[model samples]
Target: MLDYDREAARYDATRGGDARAEAAAEAVEELLPRQARVVVDVACGTGIVTARLRRPGRRVAGIDRSAGMARMAAARLPGGVVCGDAAARLPLLDGSADAVTMIWLLHLLDQADSAAVLAQAARALRPGGRLLTTVDKNHAAYHTGGDVAALLGPVRDAHTPPQSDALDRVLGVGSGLGLTMSGRTTFAGLGQGRSPRSWREVIPKSPWGRRMDAATLAELGSRLGDLPDQDHPRPDPVYTLIALVKQD
Candidate 1:
């Protein structure tokens, strides 16, 4: 993944800013309990969405591996932001939170790391507590057209996260740890859709692109160059959030 510490500065701007943050928080909330007392958002980059998730009864805290990202989150949430690795053990105690969330996180990891993060999320939740996270992230990048989606085939399947039939496996991972899928929700990616040319520039920085062979990347670039609307944004995707509950 791109250096999150380096990316922290431009994260919100490149992402959909507050408007997108609000939309994401709302979607996550829809999958959360109506009255959760403690909610910890793992990999809460910059705490933008975490801040918006604060509700009357909810006490929100953010944890991230990027010190730079955590600094920004700390400013927004004070001491509520803990600079820590989500793939390893968090400083949190077991069964400490009513809800644990890892939004837009899992797809960024390899299969092993994604499982570790999910394990951590499950460890941080109380029995019967909910764990909400985003999955099928790359799929969102192409809610626009078959052409764009076809070109990004490799990137689209670069994850072990929930999306389409893959969701069954994701739930299986959670179920093995006593976390079962209970519900889900979706939100507009707003301002996140991209055209082929622009997406070509993004390939190298993406998780899949980082590991892609030079020949394949070159071919992808060639294909992208052939597409129309070189600079225009495509249709914004509907991002999905899956909610799982920890069994007692």
Candidate 2:
């Protein structure tokens, strides 16, 4: 996981920025029930997308674990953001929120913590309300079917941990907690593609990459270096979102 406090300053620019935020918010809104008025965005880093989720007659607030990230969120939504750990508890009353969103949160946590966060989200949601979240976040980058994926797919999969936000895992967990899948959508991660050189730089710092042997890392770096258009980014990744509605 990243030191979100340190990354907060550059989070939006480095991420897909406004373009990506717009697409994500549009998709989320589509899945959200029109009657949903009280929405809570869990782990709503920087509130970039959270702010965009707002609409007339609807109230949206954000919750984040990092003070730095929450500060930025609070600026976008003054008096509407809280700094707290969603995996443990949400500050909202039980069955208080009409909707809860976890945009890019679960992939950062281990399975146990991810389950805890899902449970907490369920606790805060009203019956018939929905929980919207992204799934398979870390692996979305490879689904573009670019040369970078072809070269590193096998190795990457072998080194990667069990993803907490994988579609099946999420579905199963949500079902167990009385949150059944109600909708699904995808959005392009605009301007968030990686080049061969960029992959070489970031791979070594990734969670899976940290477990790779030095010689293997060096060889993978060499392979990435040999690819053409080292600085030209490949196709953008399309991220998946699923809406789970709480049963009465």
Most accurate candidate by lDDT: 2
Per-residue accuracy of model 2 over 67-180 as CA lDDT, tens digit each:
999999999999999999999889989999999999999998989999999999999999999999999997888777979888888888899878999999999999999999
The models' CA-based lDDT, in order, is: 0.84, 0.94
On a 0 to 1 TM-score scale, where does candidate 2 land against the true structure?
0.96
TM-score of each: 0.87, 0.96
Q: Please report, as a residue range, the 10-residue window in candidate 1 with the lowest summed lDDT.
A: 157-166
Which candidate number maximizes TM-score?
A: 2
Number of clashes in every candidate structure? 0, 0
Candidate 2 wrongly placed segments (more than 4 Å): none
Q: Deviation in angstroms for 153 in model 2? A: 2.0
Off by over 4 Å in 1: 154-166, 204-220
